[model samples]
Each structure stands twice: as C-alpha cells, then as structure tokens.
Target: MNSKTVAELLSQDVTLQDVTVKGWVRTFRANRFIALNDGSTINNIQCVVDFENFDEALLKRVTTGAAIHITGELVESQGKGQSVEIVVKTLEILGDSDPETYPIQPKKHSFEFLRENAHLRTRTNTFSAVMRLRSSLSFAIHKYFNENGFYYMHTPIVTASDAEGAGETFKVTNLDIKNPPLNEDGSVNYKEDFFGKETNLTVSGQLEAESYAMSLGKVYTFGPTFRAENSNTTRHLSEFWMIEPEVAFMDLAGNMDLAEDFMKSVLSYILDNNRDDLEFLDKRLLDEDKTKPQAERSDMSLIEKIKFVVDNNFKRVSYTEAIDILRNCKPNKKKKFKYIIEEWGADLQSEHERFLVEKHFKCPVILFDYPANIKAFYMRLNEDGKTVRAMDILFPGIGEMVGGSQREERLDVLKEKMKALDISEEELWWYLDLRKYGTAVHSGFGLGFERLVMFATGMGNIRDVIPYPRTPQNAEF
Candidate 1:
C-alpha cells in the first residue's frame, strides 16, 4: 500500500519498487499520461502508462476527477517539469468523475463562477493553492502561540455579552421563528428561550479571552466569529475566523510589538515551507494583473509583498499624526475619498487606511491612540480624556488587518464608559468583577483569518479564500 502522497513520491532522489499512490486524476492526456493530485501539494505527479499493457475498458474509466489507486515503480521521469514519474503496474478505479457533468473543467473559470461552485472549486490549482496556504497559516498561528508560552484557550461560541458591542450579532434560540415569545414591549422574550436569556453567536472572543489572559498570563484564541452586518463587499463575511491574543501586563506599545512579531513569524513560516504554493499564487496574481487597468493593478507581486512585510518594520504613528497626513494628502484635498477626513475625531475609512499603508508609508502602518468616541469602551482612556490606547494595523490593499487595544483596567472608569454607552451593569457583572478584583494593564487584538488568507493569496474576494463563505443571503454549500 502506498501511504505516501504525490508530493512525497515526487520528492525522492532514488527509484522505489511496488510504490503506490492514490489520488484524483487531474487530466488524462494522449491516452498515456496522467496528472494526479491529492491536495498534498500544488504540483501534480506525472503518471505514465503504457496503453498496450492496460485493458481498453480500464483506461476508459481513468477520466479527470476519477479517484484511482495505482501500484507502480517510481522512476526518473523522461518528462520536462517533474523529477520523477510512476510507471503503473496495477490500477484500480475507486471513484469516477464524469467529464460531461463535472463543474470544474480543465480551463479558466471566473472567480464568481467558482464561488457559486465552491464545493468543487478546490480541484482547481488556484483554489487548491489558496486553501493549502490557508491551512499552513493556521498551523503557524497555533505553533507560534504554543511555543511562545501562550495557552490555547477556547472561548464560548454562544454568549450573552456582545464582544465590545462591535456589531450586530446572530441570535441563538430554540424558539420558533414564526411565533417567538414576545414581551410587553413586543421584543423577543429571550428569557423563555433555551438559555433563559438572550444569546447570540459571538462577534469577538477578545473579551472572554481577556479573562483567561489575565489568569493564564498569555493566551490566544483562534476560532469562528460571526457578524450580522448585511455587507456584501469583497472585504466582509457574515462568518469568519479570528486570531486573538490577549496578554497580561501588556500596554499599547507591547501590543504593537506582539502583533508585528506574530504576523512576521507566520508569513515567514509560509515563505519557508509553502514556497511552491506561494509561487503558484504569485504567478496567478501577475496573470490576473495583466487584465486590469494600470492603476488598478498592484505594483508588487504577491510573494514580493509578503517578503516586504516580513522584512520591514511597521511604521507606527499616532491617530493625530495620521489625521494630519490625511487631511493635507492629495486624495483628501482633491475630494477623491468618498468620506473626507475633515477633522480629528472622525473615524478613518478603508480609503484612508490604504493611503497610509500603500501611498504614504509604502509599507505596513500601525495607527494608535484613536478617539475615545470611535473606539470600544474597553480600550484604556488616555489622560486627555479624548483618545484611547487603541491601535489598528493596516496592510497594503487591505485596511485594518488588526484592531485591538490596551483594555480599561480601572473599575470606575470602565463602569463610567459602559454607563455613558448605555450598556447595563447587570449584564456584564462578571466582566466588571475582573476589573474590581485583579485588573491590570492588559492588551489584545483580533485579526480576521480570511482577510489574512486573502492578503497572503492575493485573492481579490473574501469569499474565494474561505471554504464555505457565509455572506448575507448566500449560504449555499
């Protein structure tokens, strides 16, 4: 039995006897050559067959997308690209894919069409490469946190506390949708529901992770987070994974250092281990760039940009400074931005963020100390009582890749902020207890995993990066 994947077999320096590989046939060409892949790597193993030795009926079943097991002798290839090939001795058809009915043809397909056929999209080289890179990035994230004395904590998926009140949340209830229990005010009476109180899919795990971080000293959560926003842009997803790391005794500066180091470590890992996949994606992006207008295309290739991020130090600027740069910038002055940056307390938009990262700095930028009104209530308030110890890491082409801050530790201040925001004290009693008892300066940040995948893969759409993207009004498998 050949337990080795196509990747393992192709990496050999010497030939092997009775070697077998099992995979889906990517293509069967010239009635002799077979391109087989098992999702182990981006490259396919060239399997050469002698048409005279195999029965005509058996060979007919070796169509594209067919699952097959081949027992053969691994030998040096007479081929041009690959180093080795398998000369088949015995072949068995495990499953057959009808070329007439299969959705994935051996040709270029639009990303929109691929997204609609997402279940079979991975069979394509582009998607396969993106998913493989996604898996590698996931592994690197956990590996980094684990090796750096951080505990891998699991936060609840269903919670009463909306994380930072960041956005709308999806309700989790057993009540019938048609006739939900209602209160005197006509609101859903969640008290009669399964949890006996209102609960929804968590928007962010940072708050819960913070409780653990306070105790564990350093901890991280890599899990699914949902948003109920009705956005249908290339940037937003109704459901996505988040990488959040909360640490005790860490302030804004320390938080910035941690975010930069963590991002670099993961990108460097992919560059070292997943170079082939990256190269494939890099080429894919360049080919895509050829079709776009000169201004719309990216100046740097995918791998080059990843390397640049890994090699350089992120430019850290205060919100005030960033505002100054944007207020007098060419885009704002010319009214190019749809939302103009007119004042200090105004929220920064995606256009503004991309400007700082791509045009102004020509590198990744970290903007810190945002206005208190614009930031979450948990962020530590500055002595000026205007801005918070908050920060956002901006990437080229992608705005706000990471958002986090040093949390408010003083019990009175936290309570005051919550009160001003009209958040009930009774609802977050436990969150307040953390401050009342053992509160210390702690900081954390949340990065959308899909956004990272999109950035890493140079995929234009968020839906293309995730396996089964959950967007508004689109949840088909």
Candidate 2:
C-alpha cells in the first residue's frame, strides 16, 4: 500500500510481488519502456508498461516530466543498463506535463541555460548531486565540532560593527531614501532611525564568536553573511555563508592545525558516505573536460584531487618566504602572472596562490605571518612590528579555502591598533572588555561555505553551489 522509493527498491535482495512507486517520467520510449526518477539517486528505474492493458489516453499522458504512480511487480531488468525494473500493472497520471512546452527534456543542457531555469535545474543529475553533497558537508561540519567539545553559537544577523572592515557590508536601515532626517551639517540624522545608528548585515561572526569563546572555551558560528560588493566574478558573491570557530588558549600553530583537521574530516566524510554523488560529479567534470582544450585539462580527476588534500599534509610557509619564491619564480620573472610579485608587502592574488599549490609546492599551503597592513585589525601583531599572525589555507583550483589568525589579546596593543585603523573604542567596548578581564591567546579561522562546496563539487562558479544566489543586478529564483 505504501510507496517505496527507487533507492529502496533497487537495493532489495529479492524481487517484490507487488510494490508501489511514485515519480516523474524522465522518458517514455517505444510506448513500452519508461525511465522514472524520484530524485533519490542519479540513476533512474525503468518501468515496463503493458501498453495493451492500459488505456491509450493514459499512456499518452505519460510524457516527460509528468508525475506518475504505479503498482507493479519488481523483476530483474532485461535491459543492459539497469539491474531491476518494475513491471507496471497499473498506472495513474498524477500530473501531466505538456511535451510541447516542457523545458527540461531528456537531453544535455548547457549550464548557462540551466542557470536561467534555476528553479527546475535540480531535476537534472548535476545540480541534484551538487546540492546533495552540499547538505552532507553541512552535517559533517556540525558533527565534527559537536564531537570535539565545541558549542554551536548563533550570532546575530544584524549588527552595528563591520567585523572584516572591508567596507563591503550591506546596510540595514528603515529610513526614507528620498527625504531622510538630516543633521545641522546635512549629514543623515540617525536619531530617528530604527536602531538609532547605522546598522548593516554582519560580514563575519568572528568578533561576536570571540566573546563567547572567552567564556565558553570553544565556540563556532555557521550562518549567512552579506556583502555589498559590486564585483561580478566567479568567486565573489553578494550573500554567502561563513563558518568561523574561535578557541581560547590557541596560538597560530594550533589555529592552522584546527583548520587542516576540520577540512580533512569534512572532505573524508563526503568521500565515505556520499560516494554516489561524488562519483556522479566526478564523471560530470570529466565529461566537461572533453570540451576544453587538452592543454588546459586537469592532470588529476575530481575524486583524486579531493583524496590528495585528505591524504597529504599542508605545507606551512611564511609570507616572507612565499614572497621570495614568487618574486623569483618563472611566472613572476617572465611577467606571466597578471599581478606580478615584485615587493615584500604586496598582497598575493589568486593566480599566485594556485601557482604555489599546483606548480611549486604541489600541495595545499598555509602562508602565515602576513604583513599587518594587509590583514584585519583583530589579528595579533608579531614582535617584528610589520607582520601579524594571520594565515590563509590555499587550495590548488580553489585558492584561499580558509582565512584565520591569532587574535590580539593585549588591551593596550589592541586599543592602539583600533585607533590607527579609525575603529572607535566606544563601538567595540564589549569586545575590549574580554581583553581587559582575562586576556589569553585566542585563535580561529573562517571558511566560505560556498567555496568548500565549489571545490568538492568541481563547480566553476560560486553561484551554482548555493540554492538561490543573491548577486549584483540579479536575484532570480
């Protein structure tokens, strides 16, 4: 009486005398063979319909994308591609999709076209596998933290401070744009605003998570973060998810250890549990590579790339040492790099990161002790006075998988850094109180949830990983 999923029926040890199944028709071939899928797995189950016993009208309605229910006997599949199929004794059309107007057919569709029809893209094999892996990775993250004595803390979505100081926060306000209240000098008067001051969606939860870490000992925040940047690149997203973990009494070395272990654990979980989806995505990427030039093809497959990260240890290099390598590397000397590494204090771009991971080091790399002027204000300053204890974990194809640092715990030094950066003492008085009360060496790191998904799924664009992407000039479902 109850319907069994395609996955359950396929995994059965014996043939069923009677089984009920519900799914949408992927294709109806020769008016006898029907390929049905229920979004349970990448493969579909064949339904052999007895066309003579069924009404001609009902058979006609079994079009592509039509929802159908069947009561049948499960038997060994006579076909070559499948192991088992349902011998349909009765069929009912739950929903009819017109063959003339159905956008998703049983043929290959371009990723660009799929993005336009984003609502139904998951019906295909690629997006469904990608989203399934996304769900699995999310669970793995929570599992790792919970089992390791970490508290899951929910940070506020709307806050008064820009944690990253990147000046890219999306403003949250309740004021009239045309005629807002103005001050004597014509500046916008926040006295009548909702929060009575300027507020924006939080860009990071690190600052708030640090407060909790001081008392809780170990805390992490996994939630949505927003940015108002207008850049439309493959890596940039206006709204994305971030994972930040803060630990008390941890130094820069321990921070790197946590990050590396966390990443390896999550990636390994997917490989062990979500092998079907991973295999599907791996083949999809390999097929996609056939369309590219051979020179640009990847030397390793998708699964191989993932296993490589999980098996090897990340190479830890100082920022100064990396700068030296890049300054004299063939790419920089020959002007092949878009932004050549020419100086000590220059920021490293994505190209430089990939060069280190893919060509030079040939493994994941953690570059630390970066120049203080290039990092955030909360990072601890080194005794050298020019660098901080910040670190970034760079991947081969996906550069900068994680960014974190040992936080400044000294009240006087933190206050000095805040003043130099124009960060007001009054705004972060509560944060400073953590240092004043019991200042200890604390460290944490943040990984963009979408970036991890991008690497794991071999998806080129960051937007494809998230369900509904919010980007500049586009917010379509």
Candidate 3:
C-alpha cells in the first residue's frame, strides 16, 4: 500500500480503511501506542498496536527513535489531544533503536545537550518546528523578491576578497602545512595555492550582488557565509546563511523601505503558512520563560511580537539621535552598560541596541547615518564627512537584524575610502570599474538567515536554529 504521512492522515476524516505509514517512533507507550512522526508536521499521529497478536520481542523493538512501518486502519481517536489515530494490523521494524543508547529520548533536553547531538536533534519537537519555519521563511524570501521584480543571483561561496573587511576570514588553502611553498620574503606562497592566490570562504555576497544589481536593476543573493571570529556566544556562528538584496538607483531611504517591507512580507508569509509550527514554538518559549525572573521574560508572546512587527511601522531614528538617547538612558547613566556610549563615534553595542528597540522605541527601529569610521568603506559618505549613509534595522531581542547602506557611487570618493582603509585597489579593480563606468546610487542590506529563523521560531541560540552550527572548537556534527 502507498504510504501516507502522519500530517496528511491527521488532517483528513477517518476512512475506516487500511493505510500504510512509515516514520520513527517518538514513544512507545505501554507497548500498545506509538507516537509516530515523519517530519511532515509538529504533531504526531498515534498508532495503536494490538499487542496480543504481536510477538513480545517484536513489541520490545518499538522503542523511541526506532524506524518502523505500520499497516493500519484510520479511525477516530479516543485520546484527548489527538482527533484521529491508526489501529495497526501489522507492524514491521525497519530499524530498531535501543532506549539505553539512543541519545534523543521522549524527554526535555537542554539546547546545549541537543547541540552535541546535532545530527539527531531534529527528532525532537523544537528543532523540527524551527527547521520547518526556517524552510518556509527561505521560500518566502525568494517569493517576495521574485514577485517584486528582483532576480535571484547565485554568488560564489569561495572568493578572493573579504567583502566585510573584518579580517576574520577562514582561509581556504591546499598547501602542505609541514612544508609549504615559501616566497623570497619567507612568507607562505599563496600563488602556489589551488586558486593561484590566497582565497577564503566568502564573508558576504553583497559585493558580488552589487555588481549584478548595477546592470540587472535589482538582485538578491541567498547563500552561506563564513566568519572566523572565535566568539562562543549564543548569537555567534562561524558559518551561517545570509540574504542580501541590492537595488540600483536606491538611496538610504529607499533601502530602509525595501528592508522593512521585505521583513514584514517574509514574517507574514510564515505566520500564514506555518501557524502550527509557530504556535508550538510560541508555547515552548512561554514555558521556557517561566523559570526566568519576571523582568527577564518577554513583554509579548512570540506570535504577538511577530504580528506587532508585521502590523506596525518601524520607528526610524538617526545614529546621532540614538547616541543621545543611549547616553541619557538609565543603563549608561547608572554605568550598567558594559560598553558605555559616551560619544558620537562610538559603535552601538547589543545592550544599547536592545534598549533603543525594546525600552525606548518599544518597536522595530531603523537607525541610519552611522559614524563613517564605524561603518564600512562602501557606505556613502555624508556631507559632514563624519557619518555615512548606513542603516541598521534593530529588532527587540535580536540586536541588529539587518545592516545596509547606500553605496558610494563617486569613483574618486570610493577609491579614496578604499585606500584609506588599506583595501587593495588592483585586487578590486573590477568592483572599481563598476563605479568608474556607470555606477548609479545603489543600496542593499544583509539579513542573517539564522537570526531571522531565531526570531520567527523564538529559539534563543543561533546554534539551535542552524542544523550544523559551525562554531569555534565545536564542529563535531
């Protein structure tokens, strides 16, 4: 017989006919009921077994994490929570899982514990829901951009340049560490490497996306990005996905509008299509928050926060204005902030950003015109020469959900900025050619895909949202 997923079976009326289902057993209760899930949905379909007819050894194999195939008849469930269930006529153990050794069991496990067993964490309810929402949001991003006259460009995962200029890049090389090709200056010869030059995993696709945007009018890149920063925080990941959209002839204001609209559209799509998963996550977050202090708990539920963002306009503020607020804010005033905002050029830390978005603005905030020294060289320089036309969209919990800016179109200014920042002119000649020939004002922003998933799923850690989180000293999975 054709196999039907648990989600499909649960959604329809009981047919009172035979149905074949294949899935991993979530739990085997009293050797009679098996909670089966096949990753179709968060909810599991209950499969009741006729233990009297089954062999004792066969029934013993129906432990948690075991893969099984069951031929059964769909009928109305007597259980309180589920509406329907399967009455199994015959059961076949496709794969047996010993409860003594299976890492994931039918119990609550810490996110840290789950991180160690990243390969099997999806068997749990939380990770599965998060991954599902992540998938939905990914689709929504492409759909939103495609429907809005934007071309999806596939950017290279490996590149010769560091787009962010952070210097924390994972070097990609195929050289013998013990005895590598050396140069006359006693330096490792990168010319002998695979690409004939020093290369690394791309830090961002924005540079490449900008080139396409200039000619294509608008383009977006969604792909993996790498960073070698050794920060072991819940929010930092060594390798993650980024969604960057660059548009030609767009200024700072237009860029802000595009980002806000894009975020709302994607969030709305998830709310509509993945309500079940969101609901599950929402409840999970609420339950998790009960153990925390009252002030530490979220002001609104997960769904409420998402809906608030979707329905409300993002409060726009200038970096100068944000600086004033941060300096005068209670945290800075009381010296509670780890990094105090004392002056105009100081970069805003996570605490400061949270205060602006959560405490002061009480909504999503867009802070623009950041100090030039604190921003990237690509951002357009302002008249004052002190700040650049950069914008960061800050969410309530997530510090900076999106970072973008209006690109400096003037060739002379761009070259000067690049030289001042010590960026190689010859290496980026192709990028410079874009500005030299026909560079019109272009703008774009990068949204960390994992951070977006964390926001949508109410998952606290960046590690939990990504399947195999690549972090410093932790690449087991």
| C-alpha TM-score for every candidate | 0.97, 0.98, 0.97
Residue lDDT tens for model 2, 1-477: 999998888887788679999999999999999999898877789999988899998899999999999999999989898889999999999999999988889899988788888898888989989998999999999999999999999999999999988889888889998999999999999888999999999999999999999999999999999999998998989999999999999999999999999999999999998898899899988998999999789878899999989999999999999999999999899999999888999999999999999999998999999999999999999999999999999998877899999999999999999999999999899999999998899999999999999999999999899988889998986
Candidate 1 lDDT by residue in tens digits, 164-193: 676499989999999999999999998899
lDDT of 1 at 167: 49
Model 3 regions more than 4 Å off: none
Write one digit per residue (lDDT tens) for candidate 3, span 347-387. Answer: 88888998998889888999999989989999999999888
What are the lDDT scores of the predictions, listed in order?
A: 0.92, 0.94, 0.93
Please report the candidate that would top lDDT against the real structure: 2
Worst 10 residues of 2 by lDDT: 8-17
Q: State each candidate's clash count.
A: 0, 0, 0
How far residue 261's Cα lies from its native spot in candidate 2, in Å, is 0.7
Model 3 TM-score on a 0 to 1 scale: 0.97
lDDT score for candidate 2 against the true structure? 0.94
Pull out the clashing pairs in model 1: none
Ranking, lDDT, top scorer first: 2, 3, 1
Against the true structure, candidate 1 reaches a TM-score of 0.97
Error of 3 at 420 (Å): 1.1
